[model samples]
Target: MTQSKTWSQRFESALHPAIARFNASIGFDIELIEYDLTGSVAHAKMLAKTGIITPEEGDRLVEGLEQIRQEYREGKFVPGIDAEDVHFAVERRLTELVGDVGKKLHTARSRNDQVGTDTRLYLRDRICRIREKLRDFQGILLDLAESHIETLIPGYTHLQRAQPVSLAHHLLAYFEMAQRDWERLGEIYQRVNISPLGSGALAGTTFPIDRRYTAELLGFGGVYANSLDGVSDRDFAVEFLAAASLIMVHLSRLSEEMILWASEEFGFIRLTDSCATGSSIMPQKKNPDVPELVRGKTGRVFG
Candidate 1:
């Protein structure tokens, strides 16, 4: 029978490096370490406050975590390839720094709920920033709308000219789309801020831990009522992705319009050199690459 190896232990048959690279998330999810460390600090404090561990141990764990955070901040945290993912990589580092007491940090939690909490923490900030940027983009569109209020453009339906319209009306329609994207992101933030820290493995822990206090420490608006749902639920992520897909759709539509407007046939607009590029073989052509890139990225986002 094969026994499970600890963090530093090698597999009985020696796991291959090629497979390790294929399964590793440390490349991208290491970005998750900031939230992961924040969650651990909250967990450690709650453990001490609730008598799950001695106050001295909790203090050590917090200090160790802060050191790890510092390492990450200073570009000094090097992840081990054998460590499965960010959670394991972090726990491995913590155990190394603070000795056995660092092992107790996972007593009342599971990587399931830990990741859920970390993703919420990470996405809460991300959604807010995306919304703010979208608002700024809307502001830019509004400026364009204001300047183009008196400018005339032909509106299209089914690739045919349908009616004459002010350029402002055409641009303002996109701002309305941006407004919806902004509001959708705001709603997503509220749902993503609930804490999932106290849900251990699949069931609630029997440690008399204070879920509410942990939630408060993490700045979560509330605690999950059902531990199973807390650990298993990813509905917030799905919603955010859906909303993001919609925003990308709006962006791609706008990009398609920009690509057409800047075309020689339409001759409706000219892109600035900073955003425009020229084809390698064509000396006279200034390509609408920025808008084209937005359109290209939309496919990857949807996928």
Candidate 2:
């Protein structure tokens, strides 16, 4: 086998042992493959434009990166353990594809900034998805509200029936909360859309590379001005985690009500068998296991 082929085989062999112990992100970070390729393409273009690399080399790098991207999309790409992160895995693959030209794609970039940029890009997309899911959840609540608009349900305070309320009104309350959650996610996405690609590690690159050109290429709103802030700032992740926590809280509240409604003492709602489970010994008991489990999982979500 050639040197590259040997390297590939060795890398593949090393992957399993590390992944089995550390929980390989090849499954998760693999999602960033497209963004990684895009970043490399933009960097190559910028390098050529800035006279750091020859236009021919940049074109070759871009073509190679595209080919690597297609390989990933076609399920032919395999990441390995020796590749420390998604950035390394991608660069390694690109090098394998185009020889020395692939190695130049990392010019004026660092894994710190590369990973940060990839993460921001990832979060931007995920936040949008989460917002869509929130909207769907809200729609479910709204449909429930409209259907039960006049249905009177006992409103609880401290787990006790404190007063009577329209079931619609109760459900709509969650709708409002979910809408705010959606808004929060949108707001956070704007902040996460800034590009960190030009920030090499903790400090900005000295290269005459145009950050704006790369930012525009990647569809980023703008490049981060402060290099240290760009690389170290995980506020976007924290914001996403916060939004997720709030949504989980809202879901937990809804799950709690479902659990209560499904209880024999409450007798307010009959959960579908699809959403419940029968007790092993208590053959008559149709337990609200789903909502209870969802509620139980909320604690882990918060933590």
Candidate 3:
């Protein structure tokens, strides 16, 4: 069956199969559906508030968008390859639900700003979750440190034993790394909370819409001062990557320590049965695969 094309009117010919396959992003951008719908709902309300669209029309648009969200939650709203990306997919579904009024939801916005807004919302939520996970990890580290305060282990320099140290002090080093990572995420969140919805394309829209109102509705700190900067800036994403790389570096270091300590030569720690695996041929060999995997995968995050 021929899939319906969302961008056919602007072009004279059907896109080549290879070009279409390469251009389609629904495979991964489906993750942004929920965030796109949320931004749409906020935009619709802003349109109504500013008299760009009738309040009744805005209500219909919001109702249709919410219905699509419900359909997604129930596993019924599936977007196929024809939709291109999450923004187009939601608009296509909204029009099906509310007819022409659903089409009015995009009056004061561009897909440039739409996608920018969606990405910021998604990253903001994810940063909060990551921070929480780091908090929990710090708690675990603290508990272990408290229990091992009296336990002594050999401190090493150049992989050779140099002096005695409390295991609690060693664990606290990781706690400090995690604390710094948590603070970095908090700083990144502030940058991610700015709204870009009114910056249509790379320029401000002609519509007399309220950007600040939409930002407030979406729980953002403020609207972007420069429209071009608002839609094009990805510094927050790069900052997040830098901070995540540091976090992985710390994790890889800790994994290296655990791997060394668990070995017979070090004899400072033991690999529990649930946390280790037996070798294929060696009858008595228990492998520290968990830490080994962590150490190996750290390079992926750095890249």
Candidate 4:
């Protein structure tokens, strides 16, 4: 990437590089490039439709954006530090490719809205993926349940055995737990699918922007009712993390049981060699490391 003018260059003083890098979000937000490009393309079409930019200019913007998207897909788009975030990085590259007309891409938007919209798009797609993987896990458990219908396992409460239960029943408890997680993700998606692109900065754009049109183009459920909340809201992210915490807790609880079952003192279950770890000095010691690691990850997620 060529040297591009920092947006802060207009201030007639350069920030200390460390401070600039500290404030930069590109390190993490680069993941937003694809969604950002998708939003830009949709916004460009809306701009042309609303007579904000010429149709020809909108075409050029789309073409340039597509090229950048291709570059990103091919791992050829490297963002410089001064670009601050993926939005600025892509815009700088777009301007270089299409000249001044690329400047008009931000005519009725701001980074606040752009980031909000990109995050929604990214998380919405991921929620679907999480649901799919979670369903697969349920199917695996159901298969195990089908095969172990008569295998008697002791049901425990407060670390005391209560009664003998079928292994199928034991596994189904977890199956039901995971099902709730799957349901929560679906609930989160309703709030995560709203578009926030027309909310310029914190308030909104002066130019007539058809928020509904942009939302439709992006396949969002609807536009945000409040412009300030559209850009500033972190509820979607917070709610996702909360849901994730529950999922992790469910996983950790299962892992704890498996870990206990794998112990020699319990001897109720034995993990396969592929997942178990053998101690360096103890030839008879096979550790349930995978379950232990899963248990550890719950703490990290909680933290």
Candidate 5:
């Protein structure tokens, strides 16, 4: 059986369940557990190498963290409300698994630096994935262009048909925009790949930490030189948002063309029913809802 609760535990017990749930970021951020474990293991090894912690303790922590990672990957782990973020959740579980030694794993680091490192790593991976998706989307556009190399379509200016253009040319316009988006994502990836592990709190630690070691361990190309800059820098997040905005704008333009092409007034092409919807009242009305939603979502992305 569990031990009796302390006053703080009892106080937290009295809190509202919704408040508890709202405070728990585990639902979404639990995806960072593996990255957190990887960072911790690297930091622990660094600590041991620098004689900050015993080699025995470092090995124990590394083994325990790997076990926790396996638990999460194998779908055997269940994060509790008390486990705030992935960092806390992993540390708490580590303590449970290996006693006092697990607590020592955070000796030279703070949650600020840890979270910063984890988020950067996660974002870097996400940016790579998004680049791949953009490439595939670009390839689709290129293929469509090749297929319609000589097909003529009305080019619009201010929603009015102003001139004729080859369908291939119009499709290539989206390809060009997508290529730019891909380049932007790559640029953001470079900016976000800097390591933030050694920036403890808002300042550097007294311990002889090798930031470069942890950076290399985590596949970061380099470390943030200033501790304060490392902890407070969110330029990567802003760049990612900017990249997303451009991608959304390109998608919105394509969606607008799709909407126009599917309409009766400008029936240049037909969108398959799988990509459209039908009106509740008008039996003959087929709506390009997917493109409409994509176009509408562009505003949210812009905001």
Candidate 6:
């Protein structure tokens, strides 16, 4: 299938196949297609409002972008490696649908800023979902804690029993950890809510583009104060990852306790047949696979 190459004329020859594969980001960035479409619609509207592009052109661009979104949902518009990245993949398809008007969608913006805007928009949505999940998990923990209010359990320090403690108190400690994770997400959302569009690679654009208007359209709090920082700053991503790592740490710790408590030596917890796995040779074996895997996999999320 034929694909559009935005920089076809800039290079002296076609890139080597190995180099092209290395340069391609479509494999993963395709996940950002929905966010990219949202950003493009906001940008097109801002361009029209500022008299950079006519209202008719802006409407056409938005309509085409929405069509692309529908195509993606219906599994009709899949962009492979030839598209290079989600930005170009969407642009290529938009051009096919709306002709030259599609080309104007990139006016006064660079891929650098475009990707920044899309990633922030994506992260903002994900952070909200994660917060909701954390709330649900905390609710579950609260219910369990309430039911076990007076149940006694051995409190341990350094994996050695220290004293008898209420099981509800132990569960509440994890609830508190999850609460901090939720708060950290809220703080990260604030930093991610700023729009980075119109930065134009690394410098401010020459066009009289309205960055604030674009931000408002995209539901962002404001525009980045510095153009250079807007396009290049990935501190929000790093911060989110760091927060996520801590969340995983808390989860891993709880998993560790579950693993230990379910052991024959401790006998603090019993694993149901549905949640435990049986060993092939050991007829009496019932492994705590869920918590064991969770504890083992926690290291992957560490920033």
Q: Which regions of candidate 2 are displaced past 4 Å?
A: 1-28
lDDT of 1 by residue, 1-303 (tens): 222334436545644567666777887888899999999999999999999999999999999999999998998987865666888888989999999998999988888889999999999989989988998999999999999899999999997999999999999999999999999999888889899888988798888999999899999999988999998979999999999999999999999999999999998999999999888898999999989999999988798
lDDT (Cα, tens digit) per residue for candidate 6, span 1-303? 333345887756666666667889999999999999999999999999999999999999999999999999999999988788889999989999999999999999998999999999999999999999999999999999999999999998888889999999999999999999999999999999999998999998899999989899899999999999998879999999998899889999999899989999999999999999999999999999999998788778873
Model 2: per-residue Cα lDDT at residue 193: 92
lDDT of 4 by residue, 1-303 (tens): 233346655665667777777778889889889999999999999999999999999999999999999998898999977888889899989999999999999989887898899999999999999999899999999999999999998889898999999999999999998899999999999999999989999889789889999999999999899999999879999999899899999999999999889888777888899988888999999988888999898988787
C-alpha lDDT of residue 74 in model 2: 91
Residue pairs whose backbone atoms clash in candidate 3: none
Name the candidate that leads on TM-score: 6
lDDT of 4: 0.91
State the lDDT of candidate 5 residue by residue for 12-40, as single tens digits.
44545566566778888988887788889
Query: What's each prediction's TM-score?
Result: 0.93, 0.87, 0.95, 0.94, 0.89, 0.96
Write one digit per residue (lDDT tens) for candidate 3, span 146-244: 999999988989988899999999999999999999999999999999999899999888999999999999999998999999999899888988998
Error of 5 at 246 (Å): 1.1
| lDDT values for all models | 0.90, 0.83, 0.91, 0.91, 0.87, 0.93
TM-score, model 6 to reference: 0.96
Indicate the TM-score of model 5: 0.89
Question: In candidate 3, where is summed lDDT lowest over 10 consecutive residues?
Answer: 1-10
TM-score-sorted candidate list, best first: 6, 3, 4, 1, 5, 2
Residue pair clashes in candidate 2: none
Candidate 3 is scored at a TM of 0.95
Q: How many backbone clashes does candidate 4 have?
A: 0
Q: Which regions of candidate 4 fall more than 4 Å away from where they truly are?
A: 1-5
lDDT top scorer: 6
Residue pairs with colliding backbones in model 6 are none
Q: What value does the lDDT take at residue 186 in candidate 3? A: 96
